[model samples]
Target: QLDAVPSFRMAVHPHIGTRSLDLVSERDKVGFETVLTSAKLMIQEKLSVGSISAHLADKYNLFNNSVKKQREDLLGQISSVESGKAATSQSSKCSHVVGHQAACCIKFGSNIQFRASTPEERESVPPPISKERGLVVREETCDALLALLTGLKGDTCKTLCLETARNEMKNAGDDNSLICDLTLLSFVRHCVEMGAVALH
Candidate 1:
């Protein structure tokens, strides 16, 4: 199971914070290029005929039974690797509070915001990621993007994807909102063009 994600990557300690992943390397020139490329990969790697067929075959299984299985397999694959890293660290501090509702979120200063969720909402509070107004790719997108971006694999990439998505949504504005909508449509068009998906 995925742990509740605390928003923000800023660290009182080094290499930790609510949204610290937004910060980048000395070798990289652009602020978001490293991240955006990863984001693109997140969407692309899943752009296979199977995934596309899966999306179309079952009338959009983006948040179906398969996702739960995917989550389980992904989490299992990465936990061992992450636990190992945490063990090596002098602090050994890589566990979330047991019952906290975890989410991928965007953090601004001390504030953290949840990203989007596949399942629709019943609660009053907004999910870190928006539903109608925004374009949420998928867990596949998250998995792929994080793998490409942080050079982290297994569950670590999952966390990285959630964190990055949170940051991406957090940065959204009116203009950005329009861009997201266009991006979603563009994604559909691109999927058809790339022969990764077929149009209805």
Candidate 2:
């Protein structure tokens, strides 16, 4: 199961936050190149009708499980290997490697965010004015997007996608409203193209 987890090399980007896995490395890069290639291919696979969301959800669960198993296995291996070595010398080496590896795994297993270091830095970042337009605007926008994406005509599907995105934006105090309609449309189109959402 641990081997089943897709392996992709990641590095922190200097600007525009962390890039997607596709932008991280070339196909010929070292370390688990085959795994990375297979992952990219799997992501490119087309989804059948009514299977897009389910397929992604299942993959998410699988990846989540795999990461958990990997962590457990890594720790177990560290423990077993250290048991036979000198306590003082092996302790420092194992701890350093394990700490670095564990940190890398945790970071890669989740979304990456760029945070401001100080109040001045925070102030330099622009606020989202559109979010202040009120929950009604969010609800309406989510309803419209949900209706277009799914055959369902109400708030039922709103919570599934659009609303959740809005809530996260709201919590982060980021105004996505200033984002141009064309860009937002492109995002939705990309989501559909990537099988993250399905249209009926």
Candidate 3:
């Protein structure tokens, strides 16, 4: 791509009168002028080429760095968006679990209220304390039920169980055959109290 170096040429100065000058001396003088002109042109051409090359290199480097920075900025934005999505997904899942737990707690409390209306209705159910073993079965049962609700994993099963319990209580009417024992009522009361405090 480079321009070829100009060939050296010999010529006599127009100002020098060839009529008065010696032919041999004129030829020598022309040869010297040719060499000087060739050397100056060559030096100028080399400097021009070097300057052009340096300018192109600087431009290319600036463009390359700009592209690299843009790519990094794009990747960083993608990472931030993905991280935000992950956090939102986790928050939604927690909210769903808390919602389920709150529903179960409310349902359990409602069932307790429906069962334990009067003093006689409460007293009719036998005490959970086993006289011989000293084991409180009602407390254990309430604890197990609370654990199930807290887990929030068995929605359909819990709903079915609650429905069955409510039906049984309804059928018992004024009889003492209802399963809303005193220990479960106490557990429900405790949960309501705790929930109230948390809200405050």
Candidate 4:
């Protein structure tokens, strides 16, 4: 209801004092002084608000500048790291070329097939999950959970799967089915490797 009302304020008008003493009464002088003091107070209030606003703006600018600096610093660090990685990769490729040339120079009986190292191969390596100290759910259990999660959103499935795995681990005390030692992430990785769940 209050919102419906127009926000209107009456303008302040300072009393004008007459220069002629004969025309000015004591009451008129008092009224003029009262209005003058009120006007001064209003001006002071406005100045106070302006000062506060300026102070707040300064603080905000300082904070914003700090955030920008931090972001720039982070981006710079990331670019340097990326450049370093690129240099390392280039060097490795050059070394590989040199090795290949040297191999060609050698009159080897037959061309030997060399397995190249890759990030995918490294990531696909399974963790050492043992029965004594690791949290491992049964493969069947994982498959079942994953089957239930089909058609669900990726994030929702991931979260739900993690939560379900945790619950299974907690409830799998003395159970022979869930006897392997694995962390939550390792369990998920295992599932991913087994094609039970697709990695996002």
Q: What lDDT would each prediction earn against the true structure?
A: 0.33, 0.38, 0.40, 0.40
Model 1 accuracy (lDDT, Cα): 0.33
Q: What is the C-alpha RMSD of each candidate to the true structure, in Å?
A: 25.9, 24.1, 34.9, 24.0
TM-score of each candidate?
A: 0.20, 0.19, 0.18, 0.20
Error of 1 at 63 (Å): 5.6
What is the Cα-based lDDT of residue 194 in candidate 2?
A: 29
Candidate 2 Cα deviation (angstroms), residue 126: 25
Candidate 3 has what TM-score? 0.18
Number of clashing residue pairs, candidate 1: 19
lDDT of 2 by residue, 1-200 (tens): 22455344443233323555656565334444565666667656644555777876787678657656555654454344333234334323332111122122221112211111223332333343455221222342454444343432223233223334434455655545533333233334333322333221
Q: On a 0 to 1 TM-score scale, where does candidate 2 land against the true structure?
A: 0.19
Candidate 2: C-alpha RMSD after superposition: 24.1
Lowest summed lDDT across 10 adjacent residues in model 2 is found at 107-116
Cα lDDT tens digits, model 3, 163-183, are 444354445452333234333
lDDT of 1 by residue, 10-95 (tens): 22333334345556343443433555565566668656789878767676444345455644554564344434234234122322
Please give, for residues 162-182, the per-residue lDDT of candidate 4 as tens digits.
444445555544232422222
**In model 3, which regions exceed 4 Å deviation?**
1-139, 151-180, 196-200
